[model samples]
Target: MLTLPQLRALYPEAPAAHLTAFAAEAARLLPAHGLAANRQRCHFFLAQLGHESGGLQLRTENLAYSAARLMQVWPSRFPTPEAARRLAFSPEALAEAVYGGRMGNDRPGDGYRYRGRGYIQITGRETYRALGRLCGLPLEEEPGLADDPAHAVTIACAYWSWKRLNPLCDAGDYAGLTRRINGGLTGLQDRYGWLERAQRCIPWPEAGSEALPLPRLRAVQRALKARGFYDGSIDGIIGRRSLAAIATLRAELGLPGEGLDAPLLAALAA
Candidate 1:
């Protein structure tokens, strides 16, 4: 449902290829993951995604830092300038020094090996193994796959789901969500800016409407088609084919009725 133009507006600095891939993947995966369930969820998800991925431009963590930068970023770890200078510009050494004994990085090279990747910057060996199981991908064995654009969104969505962060979004708890995602309030203002921009770009459903808007209906149609429950053209109209597809999906999920409601949307998304 997120248009290409809207995505471009959201991430003007992203490369054209990255924008295209992210747009397609978001359209397919966001709804499927229930991240697009409502305006709040969509805006919150995009805000965090934009902030974490640097507006969808970065798939891997940048460990290269100057001594002054290192001193500022990790003051507790590198208290003095001389200490920071030792690992300055040495990404692998810095990674090892800071991340070696934490986040399930016990092996010699596990620091760099399990460094952050993907849209949300998934980090750590334990996280990679867990997400790999959720996504059915060998992320722990081949961490670089998280850098691939196709897999990045999947990893992000899986991470979001695994963390069960949607309720915070539903509760409008941006600070709570940020803490869960970043372990702190880092870049909180920037995330709020993205959320404001997303709110302006993406419209919410009007109250008292039984049928979804055209764009959302089209998204549902696409989801149904992907699941082989619908074979009709995705014209955004709730025609016989669409209804039949919904009916079939409801039957499979053991859900009652053929109505378009929150439960149906959630089921289709699931």
Candidate 2:
């Protein structure tokens, strides 16, 4: 329902010229795996990218694209946090202070070299390590990539893909996406008073069409297979038998039988 005009209205400053170029590039890079970005989602991504890079002024924007290039020159190669911090951290002592202690929990501390991170800044060293693994980037190896917008955006894209953040389904409307992707509704209530008043990004699909689709369906099949519920195809289709298998898992897991859709998927993930 979000239109091109609506997209421009959200971030009027995004260069029309650059977006045209980016659209071409994105079309090339995406949809290879049915990962196409519709008009609104494209704007959603661009808005995030625009916000992160000071409206695209920072060279660090979309760091993953150039991380390998930067690493070729920077080459993290650390003997210790102390050695890495000397170059990457603001103060070696402070840097050591955060990550120096055995890491636990997710809250950001100034001690870690990559103090704040993620698409919208989920801070702390533990997050960096976890995100690195999820995205297949050696976050500890190149601590600087966190600050680079290019790497940051690529990491964002990778993170989105890693978790399959489809607004059309699974993400529990917008608040859930905010909680999961933006790290637990920290800024939503404060920023827009939208906590009590949730914003609608994508209308949750109706039943039938709302059935779990590929990759997600595949995950459900895999989980059921692991639990020894369904012995059917691992193909990404949720047929009637898949539902029965999931119903069995639901009864065992003590969850309400919500059949084969978002609620079930959410419970499965939980």
Candidate 3:
């Protein structure tokens, strides 16, 4: 089970109520879903959850995009800057335009009605119906229920089980797992960073028995080195040199506190 401190470390910016709710629900539901079967499983599951929920700060999808962002995100749909501008900052319009005719959302208001919600962002009417049946919740009738942290955790766990993602986690197939969850490899590095941070924060019994994967550290090292804050080899080992580099980078970026967090990861990635 994850302690409050552990949850806080994983999501430093999460609200107190959300943190408390997630901690309780994760502790209660993770084991039931076999997500806590091992350190690796727990790390991967929490990492994906953290990434999907934006460090536990978001339950519903934010469809308010700038025109440029909309064009970049859905090039085929928007195609032109003017086309995207028409829908920009209009969440309902954007949702209806982009999601209306797909994902079993054929009815007129079904897109906005069944927009992405929950930790894993369960979108569309069919998904809501399926997860609703599995969780014994009227998610289709009451989509807002998925916004609750407890229900979000339940929906995420059910989605995980329905997707049969444990074998992929067991095989250390992070890319495949991302593809399954995200429908692609978007934010793959961010997911890895979340996993690395979770591996460090969570009190896994087998933690120092072997060298853990360090893709996040490697990416950080590369970023720091590129910015001339670090000169060490990009071997993914966080030694004194890496720590110093991270501290310097954080200070330079006006970010408070110490060590790697979500903000630091985003800055590095950006």
Highest TM-score: which candidate?
3
Clashes of each: 0, 13, 0
In model 1, where do residues sit more than 4 Å from their true spots? 207-270
Local lDDT at 182 for model 3: 76
Using lDDT as the measure, name the better of candidate 2 and candidate 3.
3
Error of 1 at 102 (Å): 1.7
Instruction: Provide TM-scores for the models.
Output: 0.72, 0.40, 0.75
- For 1-270, candidate 1 gives per-residue lDDT tens digits of 877788888888877777777778887889888877877678788878888888888778879999999987688889999999999999998999988988999899899999878879888999999999999999989999998877877888999999999887765557678889988766766777677766766666644322234467779999999999989987565666887888888888888754576788997772
Against the unseen true structure, what C-alpha lDDT does each candidate score? 0.81, 0.48, 0.82
Q: Rank the candidate models, highest TM-score first.
A: 3, 1, 2
List runs of model 2 lying over 4 Å from the truth. Answer: 1-25, 28-110, 133-136, 167-172, 189-270
| C-alpha root-mean-square deviation, each candidate | 14.7, 14.0, 10.6
TM-score of 1: 0.72
